[model samples]
Target: MPASPHPDPFTGWLRDHAAPLTHLDPEAPLDDLEPLRDLIGDARVVAIGEHSHFIDEFIRLRRRLLRFLVERCGLTVLAFEYGFSEGFPLDAWAQGQGTDDDLEGHLGETVPVGVDDPLRWIRRHNAAATRPVRFAGIDIPAAGGSLLPALTPVADYLRDIDPETLPAIEQAMRIAASFAGTSAASAAPAWARLPAADQDALTAALTRLLIRFRAVEPLYVSRGDRRDYDLALRRLEGACQADYGFRAMAGLFAGNGLTADTSARDVYMAESVLWHLERSGPGSRIVLAAHNAHIQKAPIRPARTQVPGPDRIRLQSTFLHTPGLDAFDGILHTPAATVARDLEEGKTP
Candidate 1:
C-alpha cells in the first residue's frame, strides 16, 4: 500500500510539545513565555543558544527569552561567552555608569563584539531595578585576541597587593607579547612559531603568579578588598587558561593536533559560570547566552588531531566543535535566518 502522507510519531510529538513563540520583542509582556516555566522548574541556569551568531532574528529572540527568564523566572545574571577577566568594566557599564559609546568601546576591548543591544536592554531594565540583572563574561580574555586582557588586570592587582611579585607577571606579559594575536586562530599559529622554551616559560610564569596569589591570600585580602582580591585571582586563573589554550591549539601546527583533551575556553567558561553563581549567593538563577555548541552535554571529538594524539578524542563539546543544542531548561529556536552571513558555508568567524 502507498504510504500515508502523515509525518512519523517523532515529528508529531515534537510539534505537539513545542511552545509557539508569539513575539521577538524583548519588551513584550511575559505571558506568552509562561510555557517555559514548567521546563525550567528549579533549574539554576537557563542557557539560550542560537543556531548562528549576530543574526538579527536570533539576537531579538535571545533578548526576548532573556527578558522572560529575568522577569518570570527571576534569573538575575547574564553569563555570556565573553572573557571572564574582562567582565568587570562591561558590568559597570551595564549598571549605567558609561555612555553608550563607552559601553560599546568597553565591549570591544574585552572581546570581539558584534552587537551592544543585549547590554543596552539590561541597562534599561537596571535603571529601576532593586536586584538588577548583572552581566558576566565566562570565556577567555579578548576571545584569545590577546593575552593582555587577562594579564594586565593581574599585573595591576599584584602591583597593589604585592609589588615584589611584579616580575613574574611581567615575564609572562613579555612572552605573550611575542605570540598573542588578534584572535585564537591567529594566536595559535603565532604561538607555534615560538620556541618551546617560550611556550613553557609562559605557563611557568602563570603558575608562579597563581602560587603567589594563593600563598599570600590573607595578606592580599587585607591589602585590598576581599572581593577585589578574589577578582584579581580569578583574572590570574584566566591567564593560566589562556596560555594553556594557546599552546594546546599550537599543537595542531606541530603535527600534534590540539593537545588539550578538551576546549580550554569551554572548560574555563563552565567554571566561570559556577564561580559567579556561587558568589551571587543562593537562590540566584542565571541566564546564560552563547552559541548552541557551547552549551551541549554531548562530548565533542577533537578535529584533525596530528602526531601524538588520538584519532578520535572524546571530550565535551565547545565553541570549537559542531553546533549543538543548549536548551536544557528552555530553548528559543528562531526560524531559519533569511539573511546570509559571511561566516556561513564553513567560513570561520
Candidate 2:
C-alpha cells in the first residue's frame, strides 16, 4: 500500500525537520541537546509543555531536558503550574531548608504528586548543587477548593504590619470560608448560593484590601523586610484573582463568559513567573512546566455559536509574546492512529 502515500504533505515536512530523539538514553546526560542553545539563546523564560500529565515517557523526557537546562544552560528556577501559595513550601524544601518528608507531604496536595520521579530528581539536584535551583508554583492556590489558603500569608503579614487592614482581609477570608469543600464541584454550589449583595461586598472588601496593601507598601517594607512584603502582596493578589475566577465559575450557567476567567488565570500565572524572574535578577533562566494549552503561543478562539456569544468576550494568547520569554511545545508526537482517526472525523488531533 506504500503507506497510503504518506497521508499528507505535512508528514514529509515534519520528517524533514524532526530529529529522532528516541535514540537518546533517558538516564544519560543531555549533551545532544546542546544544539538547543542556539535556538534558545539568552531567553530568560523557556516554557516546556506536556500534552498530558502522569505519562512516564513524557515525565522522563521533561526531566532530561530540565536537567540539561539546569546543568548546562544555567537555569535557576523550575516553575510548575501548581499554585504559588502551595509552592512555597516545596521551594523551601528544594532549597534544602526542609526534609524530604516535608516536601513529599506538600507535593501530595498537588497534581504533580502522581508523577514522583521527576520531582524527586529535582529535589536531589537542588540539594546537591552549590547554588540551589528554586521551585515555583505559578497558579492560584485553589486546587483544594476555596481561595482562603492564598489569603493566610497576606492576612498574617497584615496583622504584623497594618492591623487596621485585618478587617477587610478577615471579611475576604470569611467569604472564602463559606465555600469550603474538597473540590470545585462541591464548593461551587456554596458560592452560587451566596446573595449577590454578599458577593459584591466580598469583592469590594478584597479590592479594598489590595488597595490598602499597595498604599501601605513603603511602611510595611520599612517595618518588616521588602521580600516578606512582596511575598505577602503576591499571595493577596493570588487570592483576589482566585476569588474572581470562582465567581466567574459560579456564573457559568448564567451565560457569564468563562474565557475572561481563563485568560485572567493565565495572566496571573505569567505574572507570577515574571515575579520570580525579577527576584532572581538578570541572566536567570527558568524552566516553566505547564500543560501545552496554557503555555502555547497561540490565541484562544471561542466557537462562533458558543454560549454567551464570542463578541461579548475577549480572548488572548497565553505566553507567546512575553518579553525575553520563549515558549516551546514539548509534545513530541501524537500516535499515528490517533491522528488518522482525528483526520477521518474532521477533528483536530
Q: Largest TM-score belongs to which candidate?
A: 1
Clashes per model (N, Cα, C within 3 A): 2, 0
In model 1, which runs have C-alpha deviations exceeding 4 angstroms?
1-7, 109-115, 253-255, 258-260, 301-331, 338-349
Native RMSD of candidate 1 (Å): 6.2
CA lDDT of each candidate? 0.74, 0.69
Q: What is residue 200's positional error in candidate 1, in angstroms?
A: 2.0
True lDDT of residue 231, candidate 2: 92
Number of the top lDDT candidate: 1
Cand. 1 Cα-lDDT: 0.74
Model 1 per-residue lDDT tens digits across residues 274-334: 9999998768899888776568655554433221211221132323442122223334566
lDDT string for model 2 (1-349, tens) is 4678546554555556555554334579576677677766777888877555444555667777788888888888888877788778777777677676776676553443223555667788876687778888888775536677688888888898989888888888887888775445566678779888878888899889888889878888999999998998898888778777767776676786665564677888999999998988667788998766577664544323211211211112233222111223322542321222223444221
Candidate 1: residue pairs that collide? 145-182, 255-307
- TM per candidate: 0.83, 0.80
